[model samples]
Target: MTDENTTVPARPRGGLLRYVVAATLARTADGGAVVAIVLLVTASGDPGWLAGALGACITAPHLLGPFVARSLDTTRDGRRVIALASVVHGATLAAAVLLYPSTHAIVPAALLIASGLLGPLLTGGISSRLPAIAGPSRTSQRRAQGWDVATYGVGGTVGPTIVAAVSAWASPHTSALVLTLGTFIAAGFVMLLPYSPPASDARDVPRPARTLVVMFSSGPLRRTLYLTMIVAFSVAALPIAAVASTDQLGTDDAAAGVLTAAYGLGNLAGSIGVMARPLEGNADQLMTRLATLVATTLLAVALAPSFSLATAAYAAAGIANGYFFAATLAARNEYAPSEIRGQVFVWTGALKITAGSTGTALTGAIVGTAVHLPLVLAIALTTAAALTSASERRFVTRQVRAADHVQPGTVRRD
Candidate 1:
């Protein structure tokens, strides 16, 4: 729901800046851990299926993000919780990287799941406290929210690029392990933040079912959720696509990361550009057009005549996706019911992670020595997303007006 004029507390701005840095690093560390796991397993002759499985394990916790964030909000020692969560996130990731080979699936999957559950603390958990950090007025809070949104966009795309690029030149296992240290660095910053969790009331935490009902009742919001999920699912597979594409082209395996890094680069560029110059009107319409573009580019990548052409097509799809991500963010805020404004961000962010996990798993199952199937499937999903863009006019506004209205928890922009 839109908080067109939401105000902020007169807290100092200093912590907000530090929180942003910590959140960015935490995101980077998570991405690095996932890629590191995938690379480690695939290099050791395990089927790529485990790679997707691990990705999903990390993402599943997002489904429970609101509850977890709420729980954190009630505690007086919220700063410690955030710090401990960060450490746990890194520790679990590092354990999986080091022990996945010997323990196989179950233990490592559990570790990743634990890490994923802590994800909200480093991201949405902190973002919710923004009113206190940004200070004095709603406009300042909104500006802060904008930065959080951009960080989410960049973190999602860049983490893979950095890790994959390093793997291209260094030991995948060692690089993965080294990258996990960033989480500890993030923990240090989080520990220092002045996180005074607001006095909590258990009665205020919206039931998960109620939150889900609210989302489903709004047609535009529902479609946006589906769009976010499908887009995420499709993008998650690109890493594996890199491996499959290289195999099909019989290129040096070391260069496979170039394809992955290219997509990340394009996505980062597109998201940043859009944020700098906000789009003019009709966010849903923009989403439809950009989603179509994304599907078309994915199709192009699938049928490209050579490895180089495929890489270019892949990057094009990423750019279109970046634009779509921005549009989706706009659509969510515009259409989400005012009653549930608080919960929208974190819940949807969870859905994105969950969708990504599904995408990664599906790709692992079907991916072989070619990129055709995964890219084609991505095209199909994005096409569905395009078709799903439009909804009955005023439907969301009507739903909000009629909603039984619960003031939910803080917004998690990611």
Candidate 2:
């Protein structure tokens, strides 16, 4: 007879490094997709609106995230599915780059839009697999989540940096080519993780409708999801704000890249700090504090008197945002039901991204009418997020414990 108390590890611990590398590569490539589209549109001398339209096209497909992740959650060989999605995403992106220079915008635009079908898989789906990849322990899972945040910091910083380097040296098309290669390489790394699959009771699987209900039914999870969306909407204004900030300094708008890079680096540094010391205590309470910090820093950034000060303030915002993000991820892990956790991740991730994309689209259309509109809106939205997170109920530790009981262990042994 099997020992009732026996503990089985999900995979070799060493696979964590491979998982992080794969996630970093996929995210870096995905992050560069917009930059590549913008550059390619400029080179092709297409209507400027085409670039933004294509960007929306690619982003719109995040709506499919839940369905994709639902399939992933129930499947045995999820790694294979993830790898295939990355490959397809990369290939289609490369094809679009080759097809669209100046003419035939329709086909290339369609391809870019199609590339988005698997976009969330490359992002949130990869994240959902972390618990199993890290193995069957809460301690290991939390540590893995910290490293997961590190991937975000690295990817966000490196993606655009790579695009800039290749655009400066070779061509916009070459930069896209480099991205394609990177995704393929990322897929290879993904396949190298330990092969055994985690098991779930099929009879216990929740229906799709039930999954949605489950997500919103939990207090901590519901609030955490809303916080993520609110903050993402705030973050979407960074590019426009960066450009405006440079204008304030009497510097060329290109100098805005410095502000952007500063934020990414600061985010990276904050994530590394989390890796050094994994988060403890209440995630919801921590989120409230971090969201407030994010707001404070964004306000400072907008009001900064000089480019140097603006960069520093923006970097500070990045650090706060990073910590807030880690808290968000942790909350999802902590509160979501084990069987539907992947779908919960995908749904929340998709919606948060949709909020960002919507903010960006609106900023270009309705918001550009005013000079300081983007920065002003960014600061306001971030402040709103802080206020939303601050609650009379935050100190209720009993709710967190209740959630832990309702939601079984996320990590499982095969």
Best by lDDT: 2
Q: Which runs of model 1 end up more than 4 angstroms from their true locations?
A: 1-16, 36-67, 72-81, 91-112, 123-180, 191-202, 242-255, 282-286, 306-309, 331-343, 367-371, 393-414
In the range 322-357, model 1's lDDT, one tens digit per residue, is 777767766666675433443565677778877887
**lDDT (C-alpha) at residue 151 in model 1:** 69
* Cα lDDT of model 2 by residue, 1-414, tens digit: 113255774367678999999999999998888898898888777788888888777778888767667766677777887899899999999999998864578888888877887888888888877876776655556678878888877876688789989998999999999998989999998888777554476567676668778877776787787788878887777766787557667789889888888888778777776777767777877777777787788788877888888889878988888888888888887788777877788788888889988777666665457656776777777677667656535545667777866667565343
Which residue pairs clash in candidate 1?
Answer: 1-336, 1-337
Candidate number of the best TM-score: 2
The stretch of ten residues in a row with the least summed lDDT in candidate 2 is: 1-10
Worst 10 residues of 1 by lDDT: 1-10
